[model samples]
Target chain A: MQKQKIIFISLFVLVIAYFGGSYLYKNWYTQNLDFMAKENTSVFIRPHSPIYGDANAKNYIIDFFDPACETCKAFHPFVESIMKKHPGKFKLVLRYAPFHTDSYYVVQMLEAAKFQGKYDETLNVLFKYQNRWASHHSPNISLIWAFLPEAGLDVEKLRDDMKKPEIDAIIKQDITDGKTLGVTKTPQFFVNGKPLIKFGYKELQELIESEL
Target chain B: MPPLQKTSNLAWNILFLCWLTATIATLGSLFFSEVMMFPPCIMCWYQRICMYPLVIIFFVALFPLDTKVVKYAQPFVFIGLFFAIYQNLLYYKILPESAQPCSQGVSCTSDYINWFGFLTIQMLSLIAFSIILILLLFFKRKAI
Candidate 1:
């Protein structure tokens, strides 16, 4: 009889915990969701921001990344996969957050590529060669220029474009925007103008899925 | 009452506590991932694999006050303890980031929640597992 009573009590406690935990987590989710969304204002998206997918797509995922960040480089493929998985349901908006000093140069190069319609290609090449050019402590920023030729980019034009004031302005504006949005790290994702309460690829995908 | 009966009663109490902690820990993990939408990393998944079964195991053992339940459940607690400790090491940066099994998306070193600057999801898991482990050890010592 005592054993049965203990078992009953144990089961009762477990049920209470399960329900109570769900309640507490739901409360945490909504509170943090609102706090996070407040910082992911539309101001984060500029008129000339680099983007992928249909412009008219109803859902947008804005990625704040640093070209030199290892985590950003690692997460790029997962982000791409998420977009591919959803098709026309989602669009990706790329914003540069040059957290590292060298990242500004890489962002400038990408912005310059926008003029030649090679923005996406250049961005891919940069990610591919990131280890060589974006490595910490001994980065070879010049190595990035070498890969441009193979991507069929006009090397001289890119160099000239990289020096343009407009490219500098774009990078500067993105930094200002990122700072306003409370982004202090690379690969920060905001889904449909809502910041991820937790940073993770699955979390980002699930958030997008929920919005969908 | 005989001393043996008294010790047996105390052992049952400790076992009950162990069961209770495991139940709460498992539910808490689910709540964070499902309701709160927090992504769990590879190490977190490993820890979950070790934790989730104890709820059923302990509940079965509880109905009969099976003393031998300790033999079955201790392995789970030990394995779970190993993972929880590893996760804490990674969380504290004592283990290098490159050593993390989370090669693809969510970083194992990522901090989802850090209460009071030191407490984290991994720390919570460690504490939970430690309590169950200590309770189980107490049960074994009493040999009820």
Candidate 2:
């Protein structure tokens, strides 16, 4: 009976510690958001980060995304449609968080496409044919190469440009920033530095609307 | 083996409680997956398979108190308890992710509803299965 009581007390303490830990972690998550949301924080935006809509827009949507994430692919059009609702009011700055295996290679393809002014079509095509290339278990760069032509990308130019150091630096910085922002999942969105703390399509819309 | 003799109301009631446990567990699993729309991971599905059938099996066993129905239900309880323990191990990351299913889409590790930040759907299943297994063992001893 005494041994059982000791075991029961230990389990109770462990449960308390578990709840306490997540609470502390949540506080840290909010504190990091508050710090990065401050104006002119380089962590929010870098010079090379891809942006859609008016660059001068007051409202910024920082999307920390993995190219291979299914949720990110699903949210792609939804986010665009959201921007369409409030034209020129919001600028989406995409930050790479390549959490998936071999997603870095896909990110390279995307960053390389920018050099030839085919970034938009490339992103669309990659998303369209994501299942063929980003197979989760065995991502194949060759398969992505086959689909790039549909996006009118100069395959030769893209190959050469992807080997550059600048794209690598951009990915590295975005990854570092993503960690600092407490991004554990893909399609993590922040509007004007305020994170979409509660995850839902409706929550995203509300956050965007409030910022608007 | 001799047939079960006329048992007291307390014994019958306790046996019925086993079915009640299974019934509640089935409804809870359905509620989380169907109503709440949280997609069940592969591990969740496996645990459900080992759990859902016991509701009917135990109910059949209780109405007549057949030893054979209890025998059939015992394997399910043991299997479900194993799944519950294995799932908790995977959920807590004690087991490596290489063995985990749904590594790509709708990550098995994704905390759909983390109650008290520690108790997850898997942990809840673990608790339910553990209780049912214990009750079933006591019922088995009473049957003999």
Top model number, lDDT: 1
Model 2 stretches astray by more than 4 angstroms:
A1-48, A64-78, A97-102, A114-118, A125-140, A147-157, A160-207, B1-9, B12-41, B55-69, B84-128
Q: What are the lDDT scores of the predictions, listed in order?
A: 0.80, 0.79
DockQ of each: 0.31, 0.04
Query: What is the C-alpha lDDT profile of model 1 across A1-212, one tens digit per residue?
Result: 87778678767877787788777855665565456556644565788887788767888788899888888888888878987887888888889888676778888888888889888888888888888887773446778888887667898988888899988887788888776665666788878667776778778779889888
Interface RMSD of the candidates, in order: 4.2, 10.6
**Which residue window of length 10 is worst by lDDT in model 1 chain A?**
A33-42
DockQ of 2: 0.04
Candidate 1 local Cα displacement, residue A210, angstroms:
14
Model 2 CAPRI quality = incorrect
Q: Kindly list the per-residue Cα lDDT of model 2 for residues A1-212, writing each as its tens digit.
A: 54335334644655565556555755676667777678447888898988898766788988999888888888888988999988889998899988778889999999999999999999999999988887764567788889999999999999999999998988999999887776767889988888877788999999999987
**Cα deviation in Å at residue A21, candidate 1?**
4.5
Which stretches in model 1 have alpha-carbon errors above 4 Å?
A: A1-28, A31-113, A117-212, B1-5, B93-105
Question: What is the C-alpha lDDT profile of model 1 across B1-144, one tens digit per residue?
Answer: 459778777877787788788888988888777765567888889889989999889878866678999889988889989999988888888988788777765677777789999888889899999999988888887865
